[model samples]
Target: MTAISLPSAMEFIWLEADLLDSHDYAAWLALWTATGHYIIPTERDAEDYAAVLNVVYDDQEMREARVKRLQSGLSMSASPAARTVRTVSRFRAMDGAAGVFVVRCAQHIVEYKYDRTRMLAADVLFWLVPAASGISLQRKVVTLINGDDALHGIGYLL
Candidate 1:
């Protein structure tokens, strides 16, 4: 097996962020392998694999369904869609068994409407599986800093 370089891993992360920031949902979904998981935790201490209080959990099918909903104009809240800006910082990498690695980063997302603005800060953990097509996401786990408070709606991608 070939080793995954840090630069390549960072590139994949940058690409993923660009796709999300651009609202290219279909392109974003295509980046995931079939068994990929997306998670946003409601509790900081909760393990993503075992947690029940997730804000969003999606396997491939569920992700596809979400994309379909967005594309079909079924998402009512998208009207005058919320604007979002995200900055990812402080990237750290942890070596996993075999060829996989876990990348951790701090993310700050600012979302706004006409008069309402909300800021979300989170620690994001990504399982990076080295593939022929570069690094594919095995899992994405987000732990919000403000998990205790009621979050305003996230109508767009973070």
Candidate 2:
């Protein structure tokens, strides 16, 4: 696997945010590896998600199921289909082993739906691996800035 350059990593990050904002679920799903995990914790200090409850803990299969639900329009929470815009910044690439890297960044995401708009600030950590096409996500950990705070329906992807 070729080492992922800084520019390439940044491009990958941008592409992901764009795809999500565009509601291109199929395209975004293709960016993950077979064993990729997407997690959102309720506790910022929690280490074991299995032992402690998490807001979102999605494996590939779970992710696919979620996409299906959103696309099928059966989810009542997604009735109007929320619109989202995300800005990714403060990206720093950290070495992971020989070829892999861990990217840390801050994401400011705004979601609009149901005649309401909500803003969420989050810190994201992505485990990136080189793939045949480009980079694939091994894991994505999103820590909400207000993790411990009471949140309304967060039905949309953040």
lDDT of 2 at 146: 92
Q: Compose the digit string of candidate 1's lDDT tens values, residues 98-123.
A: 66788888889888887988899988
Q: Indicate the TM-score of model 2.
A: 0.93
lDDT, residue 76, model 2: 81
Model 1: how far residue 156 lies from native, Å: 1.6
Q: Please report, as a residue range, the 10-residue window in candidate 2 with the lowest summed lDDT.
A: 93-102
lDDT of 2 by residue, 1-158 (tens): 67787788889989999988887899999999998889999989887776788888999999999888887878888766788889999999876766677899999999888788889999998889999998998988899999878987866677
Off by over 4 Å in 2: none
Highest lDDT: which candidate?
2
Listing every candidate in turn, what is its Cα RMSD in Å to the true structure after a full C-alpha superposition?
Answer: 1.8, 1.4
What lDDT score belongs to each candidate, Candidate 1 first? 0.78, 0.87
TM-score of each: 0.90, 0.93
